[model samples]
Structure formats: C-alpha cells, structure tokens
Target chain A: MTKPLLTVEGLVKRYGEHTVLNGLDLTVREGEVVVIVGPSGCGKSTLLRCINALEPIQSGAVRLEVAPISRESRDLPALRQKVGMVFQSYELFPHLTVLDNVTLAPRKAQKRPRAEAEREALALLERVGLADRARDYPRQLSGGQKQRVAIVRALVMHPQVLLFDEVTAALDPEMVREVLDVLLDLARQGRTMLIVTIEMNFARAVADRVIFLDGGTIVEEAPPEEFFDHPKTPRAQKFLNTFTFDAVKRPHPSSLADPTT
Target chain B: MSIAVLRDYLPLFARSALLTVRLGALGILLAVLVGVLCSAAQYFRLPVLQQLSAVYIELSRNTPLLVQLFFLYYGLPKLGIRTDPAVCGVAGLAFLGGSYMAEAFRSGLEAVDRVQLESALSLGLTNAQAMGSVILPQALSISMPALVANVIFLLKETSVFSAVSLMDLMFTAKDLIGLHYNTVESLTLLVVFYLLILLPISILGSLVERRLRYAGSGT
Candidate 1:
C-alpha cells in the first residue's frame, strides 16, 4: 500500500456547544479517491473544512504528510499548498479573467514567474476545454463551465489531496453531469481526492471506497459495491433507502390489501 | 452687478480657485491614505491599533470639520506649537474625511463574502496576502460609489479651509466683498467657481463607478 498522504486522528469540530464532528478519523493514501456521503447537517462539509484548516479544530490533529495543519504552525502555508479545496459556489475571483484566476496563486503565493505560471495555466485551461474562454470573466460562464474552471484552478496548484465540497449541489440538473464528468476524469488520472457528493450513480462509478456518515460519526465504510449493495449497519441501510425511489413509488402492503383499486 | 468689479476679481478668483483645487486634492489624497490605513487596522483587528483606529473613527466622524479646523488652527497655538496654515488645512480635511472614507471602506470590506477568504487561504495564501489580493480588490470595487461620494464631500468641505486664513475660494470671495463691497458679483463668482470645481468631479466619479460595476459584473 502506498503511504498515507493525509491523515486525521480524533478530529473534533464544534460550533459553540453543538458538536458537528465527534472524534472522526480518516486517512487517504497516495492516489486514493474517497467519497463521503451523509444526510444534511451531518458534518461532512465541516470535516472537509477542518481538514483544510479553514475551520479551527477543537481537539484532533490533521496532518499533511508529517507537518501539522494549524494556524500557528510555521509551515502551514506550505502545507496548505498541498491540500486544494473546491467549494460548491465556485468561488472564482470575479475581478480577474479566467487565465488570471488560474495563475494568481502560483504567482502570488508560490512566487512563480509570470511567464512560467501563464504557460502552465494555459495548458491546464486547454486540458479542461476552457482555452477559448481564457480571457473571459467568471460571471460570463455557465455554472458547469465555472465549476470546471474551479476544478482546473485546484488542479493547477499540483496539490497532493483535493477536497470537493458538494461541487455539483448548486448546479442546474443538466449542468451537474458536466462537472461530474470532470471529477470522473480526475479520478481516472488517479488523483487523490476526498469528495462529498449526492450523485449516487457517479459515486458508484468513481469511488474506490464509499463512506456513510451520520450524527457526526461514520456509520459504515466499505468498497463501493459492498457498501451500496449491502449496507451492514441499519443506519446506513435506512440512509440508502432514502435515495431509492422505490420507497415512495411502491405502495405499502396495507394499501395494496385494500379493494379500492 | 458691476462688470468692472467682476472683471477685477476674476484673476484673484482664478488664482484662489487653483489654490482650492490644489489643497482639496492634497487633503483628499491624505484622506484616502488615512482611510485605507484605518480600515485595514479595523479589518485585521490588530491589537492596540484596532482600538486606536476605532477611537479615531468615532472622534473624527462625530465632530464637524469646522470645529476640527478651529481646534487645529486656533486652538493648538495656545500650546505654543505652531502648524503651517497649509499643513493645518490638509490635516484638518484628512482628519474629517478619513473617518467617512474608513466607514465606506469598512463596509466594503465587510461586504466581501467569507468564501473568498477561504478559497484564498486554501490555496496557501497568508491572511495578509488573501486580504491584499482577493479581499481588497472586491472590497474596493464595492466601495467605489461611497469612496467617490466621500471625495466630492471632502472637496466641498474645503470651503471650510478659508476659516484658517488660507485665501481659498471662499476667502477670496469674502476678501473681495469686504474690500470692494460688490456682494452680488463676488457671491456669483463663488457659486460659479464651486460649480466648476464640483461638477467635473461628480461626473468623473460616476463614470468610474459605472466602469467598476461593469468590470465587477461583466455585464
């Protein structure tokens, strides 16, 4: 097995008295793709935010390789560079062109030269099929296109781990496929990604391991096939049942027994 | 109105108008500099500096510019510390305008969505870097209208500079009326000169505002 690229041990996050993540622990090895799914307010997004050090943790530690992720750590900036995150809103810098947005971090934070960063950014933009829109502002693009640009933005950082927080949740129904396709492409390339998503089909297609979380704790985790087809825990079974249309569409036996039909 | 009196004072008005423009520009520039610094202090929540900035904003904003100028020019010499009239004029204007500009800029800074900072941080940018690059530009764009309004306001406030005996446009008009007793011509020239000074700025301010809106919205 490849070495762990990211590790979380006893991760605790709280907003005031209400604990959002209750001592959750997770690990991602090199080039592993982990898909986390849970009901609303289950702390999946908070977990990702804690991992990225966007939110301060209450107790547990998150480490990128060997260095700890925290506000006080001297190497935090360097460590954060290795963990790229894409938000659901597609938070592109509105004042910049697509090309400029892609190049900003490399140039400003990484201190890369303008010419070199632009060269790499242009290539990445081309890879994402956004070469034609390089000079366009973010507002001019469709939701899918903006999400794709966001993915490219994260990718250009050459991060070892990528966190996607419902990257498709805000998209139009038709636009969701385009963003999911991009994620599938990234997974195919063996990029290390921790994605929180609701698209079950895409999750089944792309996830190496599926994790079911509830009430701020992991209920079950297994390979996608086993987890989805045969969820061992009753909570996981109950959660999975919510996603299936059969629960609502099929009539209950009591109703079927009635002769009203 | 006598044409001869109007003709005689035209040159004086022109020179005084130039002085008003120069002083107004200086004061407005100082106001912007102070405003940016104070707003940054408030936004970053620096230890003592933040408290100092808060006090400064309240102190400046609550008092009138006339009172501020009086305190600076007439009140300060009692302590045996003398300030150049020009310096006093600029400082007084900045002291007044800075708080207004700071309020405008602080609102702009506050309006920036929290996600921008998060995205910038996740990309490994430091807090200062995130603020300078990601936050400030958007905030400035949002603050453009308020900032322009503040600028026009500061320029008009320069009318108070004559109270410090600077021979600004108002002083020139008052001096001419005192000497020649041609109140109508002097006051008319005062109105015309102020219009000339303020109209261009208001128009230019709106143009810049529109440009920023287009750039921000891409519409």
Candidate 2:
C-alpha cells in the first residue's frame, strides 16, 4: 500500500482547563479530499490550525510524506510552507492589492523572484476566476471575491496539503456558492484537502471521505455515502437531524428504522 | 528719529537675527536626534534606558525653561563646566524639545496595531527588520504633526536664552531699547520678528497634518 501523504497521531490541544482536541488521529492519502463536519465549537478549526502549526499542539506528531527521511520534527514556519491554510476571515493584507497579497509570501518567504511570483499569482487568480480583480484591494472586493483571492494567495505557495477552516462561514448566503465552486475546482485538480465546513451539499458532492466531529473527538469517519446513509453514532444522527437535509438526496444510513409501523 | 541711528541699530538687529536663526536651527536638530533616540529606546522597552528617558522627560517637562537655561548656563559653570552662551542655549532647547517629542512618539508607537508586527514575523522578518521597515515608517508618519509643533515651540523658547547673556534676537531688542529708551518700538520689532518665524512653521504643520491624514485615510 502507498504511504499516506500526511499523518497525525495522538494530536492533542488544550486551553487552560478545557481540552479542545482530544488525541485525534487522522491520515490522508495523496490527492484525497477529506471533509470534516462538526457542530460549532467542536475543535474542527483548532484541528486544522494545529495541522499547520498556527495553533500549538500540546502533544502529538504530524508527519508529512515529503520529509520521509528525517524522523525529527521541523519548526512551524518550515511546516507552514508545506501546508497552506485558508481562514474564515479571509485575512488578506489590507494595504496590498489582490495580486500583491497573493504573491507576497512566495516572493518574501520562499524567495521567488518578483516576475515569477507575479506570473504564478496571476495564474492562480485566473484559476479562482478573479483575474480581473487582481489590482483591487481587499476592501474593494466582495466577500466571495476576497475569499477567492485568499485561496489563490495560499495556492501561490504551492503547498502539498491545503487546510480550509470554515472558508464559507463569513460569506453571504448568495456568495457562498462562488467560494465553494473554487474549492471544488481545487478538489478536482487532485489536491489533498482537509476542509472544515457546514455546507453539507458541497461536502457531500466533493469529499471522498467525511469525518463528523463533536465534543473534541472524531465521532465517525467513512466514505460520504456510507457515513451519511448509515450514521452509527446517536450524536451524529441528532446532529444531522438539525440541518435541512433535503438539499442532498443522499439517504440516511439508518433510515430504514424510521418506519411508522 | 535720526537716519544715522536707524541705520546703525538696524545692522545690530540684523546680526542678532542671524545669530538667533543659527541657534534655533542647531538646537532643533539636536533635539530631533536626541528625541528620536530616546523615544525608540522607551518604545522598545529597553530596561535601564527606558527608565532614564522617562526620568529625563519628567524633569525637563516639569521645570520652567528659563530656570533650565539658568541651571545649564550658570549652574554648570559652578561645577567647573564652562561653555559658551550659544551652546548653553542649544542644549537647553534640545532638552526641552526632547521631552515633548518623546510623548509625541510614544503615542505614535501606541497607535500602530500589534498584528502588523506579528505578520512581519510570520513573513520571516527579524524583530529589528520589522520595526525599521514596517513599524517605524508608520510611527514617523503619525508623529510628524506633533514633531513640527515641538519644533515651533523650541524656536520660540530660544528667547529664554537671552537671560543667560546670549545676544539672540530678544537680547538685541533689549539692548536697543535700553540704549535709545524706546521700549515701544523695540518690543514691537521683537513681536514682528517672532511672527515672521512662527507663522511659517504653523502653516507647514497644518499642511503636513493634512497630508498624513489623507495618506492614512487612503490606506
């Protein structure tokens, strides 16, 4: 069997008295799209942040396949270049144009030349369908457009794994689809992604695997068809019942037991 | 009312004006350099240096400028440190200007968001590089209007130096009034002299404040 592209073992995080990630273990194969679905405040965002070292983990090992030779862990900055993240807030540098924001990290941190980084940024922006908004500042763009620019900014670094932390949480209901479409395109391109989202239809359409998290632990993990159709945990069933489930036609796994007889 | 008297005293007044301008320029320059250094030290939280700068600012700001000038010019001589009256004037102005400048800079530093510094660090910039390239530029822009005000105040405060026996503009006016016993004419010339220097500074300060406000808004 091929080794997984990224592996996390016993990942744990805490904030004073409260533990957020409770020894979560996950592995992603190369080019796989994994979606993490959870209720609000269930450590899904914290898990994604920990993967990129944006939030410090109390204890655990995150190993990437790219650095297979060294068992010794590297620092956060080195790991960050390999795992790019898209935030819910779309934290674009306010002073820079969209093109400059996309190119800043590649040019400054990665030491790529200005011309080369600009070309890559333009191409990525084109991919995200925001080519015309390149010269505009973040404040000038709509919420959807800013999120697309942020995705392109992260993509410019050419990271091996991408982490999406509620990328559509801040968008207007009408604008959410545009941002989701760009992410779907990236997923189709065979990029490894770990997305944390509440968009059930989008997750069901694009994700090969879905992990439902609650109370600081992974409650269920399986292919979307099996997990959504036959949710084994009582918590997962209760959680799914809260959402308007008619958007996706996928049947619940335990639906047969709902007979009126 | 004699033409000979007007011509002779006019030359003296002109000479004293030159000396006044020279002293004011040099004093403001020294103040700017010292103030910037002291402000930076305090802002960066350098331990002993911050305490020293705070003490200096408090002492200079609280005391009267006239007394400070007397202390530097007269008190220093008692301690066997004899310097020229012009040097004493410059030192006193610089000391006073530095105190006000420090507060201006402290507010400027405080106005910058801490996130900008964190973003710089995330981009692999060292602490000093981030401070020099990112923080200081914004801080300096924020401080410019207040700094200009301090410069104008320092220029006007140079009159205090006349008490220490420096033949600056005020001293020249005093000498002419004493000799000719025309206090009204001499004091009127002195007022005009100050307005000439101070009006331009006030105008420049407003212009710079407007520019900085525009730049800040555009960003």
Top candidate, metric lDDT: 1
Model 1, span A146-222: residue lDDT tens:
98999888888899999999999999999999889889889999999999999888889999899998999888999
- Scanning candidate 1 chain A in windows of ten residues, the lowest lDDT window is A243-252
Query: How would you class the docking of model 1?
Result: medium
Residue pairs with backbone overlap in model 1 = none
DockQ for each model: 0.63, 0.18
Residue pairs in collision within model 2:
A229-A252, A229-A253, A230-A253
Q: What would the per-residue lDDT of candidate 2 be over residues B13-34, giving only the tens digit for each residue?
A: 7777778888998988888887
Candidate 2 lDDT tens digits, A1-261: 445988888888899979998999999998999999989999998888677555567887777775521223444455566777887877666556788777767776778999999998888888878889888877888899988887887888888888888999999999999999999898889999999999988888999999999988899998998878788899988888778657667776678677773
Per residue, candidate 1 scores C-alpha lDDT tens digits across B174-212 of 888898788999999999999999999999989887777
Look at candidate 2 and tell me the lDDT of residue B28.
86
